[model samples]
Target: MSERPYVLLSCAASIDGYIDDNTDERLLLSNDEDFDRVDEVRASCDAIMVGANTIRRDNPRLLVRAQQRREDRVNRGLPETPIKVTFTSRGDLDPQAQFFAAGDIEKIVFCASSAVDKCRDRLSGVATVVDAGNPVDLTAVLAELAARGSDD
Candidate 1:
């Protein structure tokens, strides 16, 4: 079999298994070193994924922040970073969220088949939304990206 194209879930977390601890409380637990390491991992990954909770809670820019790596992508003619992704089983992604306004960064959202009308209407090309059966399927998300020239 061929080596499967990998999609990475790279997230920062606190000791309590959250992308951030005291999530609603908005306490910071990560340092610059941790963020740099995350940038390094993102430089190598084909695509990155996050959950609805993570997106809504963070309102993150979601771009790799390493200047050196951004230059490398320019040298190689690759994208500034890998695809940024979000998952919402209902397809009810937040269009007004900061993530949607990140220019030059490609985003993909995965929704349950039944949620197509519910979510897609609000989002135009802000992100590509796919119906991956009910309850949402991560595997289908990866496959869709791969087919669209996003795989390694």
Candidate 2:
């Protein structure tokens, strides 16, 4: 088995290589068929992660949407929803966002070392804040997640 969680970065981009059309309204980049596929993937993973910008922009719940999928996870001794993770440089995440408020699963925030204290203070009741070095170390973040038993 691998020491770190298997990471999959999924996204939809426009033909022009942009994720959005630069509008205030959220764009629908993926179709319903793709959404179902994404739900399946979410159900299979031990945790789901996004950046701070994604949390602020999309405000996703990141939960397993299908009841059967959630049940399967529970039957397999996993939470109904996977753990949620986010990385930030400024720790400017909103505690009221669905990323924090929508699920009973664990929420982890990897922030820059300089912002750790501030993030912990602000997100005390919402998420567990971890320092990710001066600029938010991706390696350390993955290692920590591995330590927490997130294998995928």
Q: Pick the candidate with the highest lDDT.
A: 2
Model 1: per-residue lDDT, tens digit, 33-144?
8878888887766567777876777787777788899888768877887777777876767787877787487777787888887788888868777777787776766677
* Global lDDT of each candidate: 0.73, 0.92
For candidate 1, the lDDT comes to 0.73
Q: Say which candidate scores most in TM-score.
A: 2
Error of 2 at 47 (Å): 0.7
lDDT, candidate 2, 8-95, per-residue tens: 9888887789888868788998889999999999999998999899899989999999999999999999999899999999998889
What TM-scores do the predictions have? 0.83, 0.95
Lowest-lDDT window of 10 residues in candidate 1?
1-10
